[model samples]
Target: MEKEFVVIGLGRFGGSIVRELNKLDIDVMAIDSDEARVNEYADIATHAVIADSTDETVLKSLGIRNFDHVVVAIGDNIQASILTTLILKDLGVAKVTAKAQNDYHAKVLDKIGADTVIHPERDMGRRLAHKLSNSSIMDYLELADEHSIVEIIAGPKLEGMSLLDLDLRANYGLNIIAIKRNGHITVSPDPGEYIQRGDILIVIGHDNDLGRFESKLEDN
Candidate 1:
């Protein structure tokens, strides 16, 4: 079976997803109540339609239930976003990814059965803060249960250290899963592998452990 996606609200978030999916040669349907916005994506999306998604009958007509995934990215209109998500779930859409305007909105989306709730703005802010606070951290991603995956640069302190000598998993409850160097990546490097200058360590651990690891790195 061919998989398909439905993007409601042809705003920045939704529109971007549509275009990216198109670039991947994936089937995507773009929808917006605004005629102009819908027209803007007509040439880009596999299908573009101007329709109010708040109405169940309209969705039924569009055969929305059969789509593999649906993203409700109604901009600024929290009520519409919530309503559309509710309708999509009620219609048994397999996966519903909704953009939440804020924390309370995310909670409601979760309670109402949104498979994934994203705060793009808030998440970007947090990600930037992590990088800024610790120059060693190039990137960070938050995970459930207060865990995170981080891309950190090795400092002079670790230049000659091997994974075995460091014993990161035991000492800091962290795992250096991969090493990136000079645009090349080494996955699951040997325990005897020594760290060199400019090596980027892809590590995963609980947030507290990560924080401790960062502080320890900064001290060196």
Candidate 2:
């Protein structure tokens, strides 16, 4: 089935999604109150409209509920963002993704039926802090409720140790989602597979548990 996406703001974040969706040949409608921004994506998106997304009448006229996904990317204007998301949900949009300005906005959006709330800047700051503070941690993805996925390099302490030896699940409540070694990726590697120095361990677990595991690796 073909998916249709409607982006409600044409700022950097929303515009990028629109352009990428166009590249993938997906149907995307770009909506912005600013005529200039709408014109910018007119040639790129499947459809570009100058409409006030906060206005329920405008959205209904556009048949926004018909789209498979709706992105509420309104920048700065928290009121408009909340209103638009509420209207989208009320109109029965199957999926509503909203960009939040801060934690408060995220909470409100979540409470108002936004299927997903993205607080990109704050999330990126946390990710960068983890990477900078822990050289072994190459990447981090924030998940709900203080959980995350992290990619950490296997240190000397873990050299030649197999997954069973680590017992990460029992000890740290972590699951090794994958292991990357020597440019080869192993998914759900057997417990008996030996870990080599510099192997990247992709792990998913609670944030505190992950921190403890990383600290233990650093200690040894």
Candidate 3:
């Protein structure tokens, strides 16, 4: 069955989520207190309504509990965000994800039973910093404080070398989880698989190890 989602707050973050979900053909209902914002996604989302999610009566009338997932992306309104999340949990929503403005907000969301609390700004800053520090790194994602996954394009030195020859795990303590070549991805590539220049390698490892591996690629 297709999953249903109700996204409250039509800010940049929430708007992006709704658009992406729509691209995937998912059912999404977009809601916002601002009539202008709600109208913006009216033609895009499955349903768009101008409603304040913090009000219990408003949520109950919307039948929010029937949705598989609910996302509270209220911007600069921590009280509303917290209140909305608490009401969703109280109504027995299957999953609730909330955007946290800061550490304290995240803690409150956690205590109120938010399934996921995301710091989009902080996470995006980290990703941008990683990309800025390494020219070879195409993208970065933080899995944990010390662990990360990165996509790096193979350079001259990596061309024609098989995975067994490079021995990335033994040499740099990094693992190439997958390789993308000519738009096709090969997951868990065999040791004998030869790496070609321009191939994009998706590697996961400790931040320090990833840094060291990136340095090696730079030196080559």
| lDDT (Cα) of model 2 | 0.94
> Against the correct fold, how does model 2 do in TM-score?
0.94
Q: What RMSD does model 3 have?
A: 1.7
lDDT of each: 0.94, 0.94, 0.94
lDDT per residue as tens, model 2, 1-220: 9989999999998999999999899999999999999999999999999999989999999999999999999987999999999999999999999999998999999999999999988899999999988879999999998999999998788898989999899999999999999899999999999999999999999999999987886673
Candidate 3 lDDT, 135-218, residue by residue in tens: 888999988568999999888888999999999899989899999999999999999999999999999999999888888777
Total backbone clashes of candidate 2, pairs 3 or more residues apart or in separate chains: 0
RMSD of 1: 1.5
Pull out the clashing pairs in model 3. none
User: What would you estimate as the lDDT of candidate 1?
Assistant: 0.94
In model 1, state the lDDT of residue 76.
Answer: 78
